[model samples]
Target: MKKTTSFVSIGTIILLLFIHGCSGCKKEAQNLSDSPKKTFIGPFMNEDSILLYVQKQLECGPRNPGSNGHSSCKEFLINFLKTKADTAFLQTFSSMVYGRTYEMSNIVASFSPDKKDRILLCAHWDSRPFADEDETPSKRTLPILGANDGASGVAVLLEMARTLSISKPNIGIDIILFDGEDLGLSGDLNGFFQGSRFASKNYPLPKPKYGILLDLVGDKQAEFRYEPLSQQAHFVLVDNIWSIAKERGSPYFIHETGNSVSDDHVMLNEQGIRTINIIDVNLVGNISTNPRRTYWHTSRDILDNLSMQTMSDVGNVLLDFLFTTSDSVY
Candidate 1:
């Protein structure tokens, strides 16, 4: 969710591993914008329930690291996941970015942990502290609401969590809610993806078959593209997902080229997990703002800019992929 310069989080579990030097230790661990066309009638995804999750996150306020909102949001997610996941734990980490130290946690919820094969679904929960891309310079210091930027992805995942919990999937599932992801400045890849980097270097669970990252998939006119790195890293995997998107009748899953973002998926792929990201880089363009779509990392990234249909499109597509795709490919 950090402003894209075309590329790229850590949490506490890895920090303890470093301090204790334990190998057998256990640990825990975006955006709103999308546009989906066609009548996608799916029993698996509930738009109203998904939208409610987004509203709850917004009611907690901006979840920037070290803030009360962040703390409350973390508790809410863990509590909710506890009801849905087989096991849930917190992966905490600390680091210094831009000369300031911040403490953060990555929430990990495991489903069907006994199954060897798994799929990773990830999204960052923290909102940008500075509206660096705001049109108004005076409002640049204000925090972003992240309705489409942060909560959209989570809302879809939360709905999926509930769905999968009630009716289990064949393969194991791991949904990672990363922290400190939007804390970096544009083009500063190292400062961003703190939680993901830690997860990559210190995988708390079995390596997933592959991963799908959802970001900015809640916009009214959301569209997804084949990321350059994802295409380069896993050719057939890209085709497989886009094909599923197509088969699911998701107009937002455009099988075209997209900007090479340094997001959470990039870190996972770097860890040899072969993950792909499905994000809507063109959100603010279609989102109606006072001066057209307000840019990312802006003060205008509030809940009013989101759409429930967009959430359903992305969520239902992933549901189909998970139900249909096989582990033999990965």
Candidate 2:
């Protein structure tokens, strides 16, 4: 049953490509006392908006990069982002999977494109084709809905984008929706992180100083343990965000480090972008955190598995992070 849980991590795989780097911005980090604007309003919070969005994607069926569902979902996301961001573009690229050629599009949305100081917030949009983690063998071939895993993070970012359009932030923001993340072939390190790898390699002019990547953050018991690679690369940034989460009394954000995960942040770090990953991998409780939670990568990763409270907590913390920065360069 746990065999699926041992599936390779995207972070571990991307670290091999980390040898390629080249960059930081000097922005004053403000404390909560000094930055009273740090206060965030939860009234605009709409977890259901995200839930509905996830349902819309699922209704298109599993969104593997080459599938019809993938094409339709990409259109939906691009159209929605156009309504929010100052500029939006679909970065089409080709990648090989299992010796077959397939095309993928990474959705890019920019806020305040002219601003020199910026931050990146990203999440993968592709759904895994194999529920390789499901306990039942019969379920392995079936596609995952990826409600919490793929859609939840994007949902939060989309909401934030909408809110930003209403009330502009001090700094520029880029919310990138990566593709081909789950296509990481077993034992093939180079295959994973396709979208991020492409973005980092050929970044649109004027890259941000730092970034935050969100993944699997809507679980009912969502507890964001500090990803090791993120912490190692950007401790101060990690500390700032976690401190805000703690101050807000958010039950979903945990201070401890969880098992190291391999996600899109690895590619950003490799390109010299100090990127942190915010993920919910249970590290607490008496059970061994080694293999981590049981629900991960399973067919159980549907809407019912998510918690609205968790989504709100993460949303508010990100809002707080944005507002706290009076200076443009966070």
The per-model lDDT (C-alpha) reads 0.79, 0.77
Best by TM-score: 1
* Model 2 misplaced stretches (Cα beyond 4 Å): 1-44, 283-293, 326-330
- Residue ranges of candidate 1 with Cα displaced over 4 Å: 1-43, 283-291
lDDT of 1 by residue, 1-330 (tens): 112111211323444545467444323210101222223344479988998999999999999998888999999999999999999889998979999999998889999999999998999888888888888999888888888788989999999999988876688999998888888877677888888888888887888988888888887767688888878777777887786677566677887897777788889888898888788765533353445455578887887768899888888877766765545456
* Cα lDDT for residue 304, candidate 2: 79
> TM-score for each prediction?
0.84, 0.83
Model 2 lDDT tens row, 1-330: 022113223433433344233111112221222333234554355777767776777787888877898999999999999998999999989987778777999999999998988889999999887787788999988777888878888788887888787876778889999998888655566777889999989886488889999988887777788888989988878887887787677877788887777779999899998899998755212243534356556787777777777877787788877766424334
Question: Cα RMSD (Å) per model?
Answer: 16.1, 13.1
**Once model 1 is optimally superposed onto the true structure by TM-score, how far is the C-alpha of residue 13 displaced, in angstroms?**
54
Clashes of 1: 29
The residue-level lDDT of candidate 1 at 234 comes to: 77
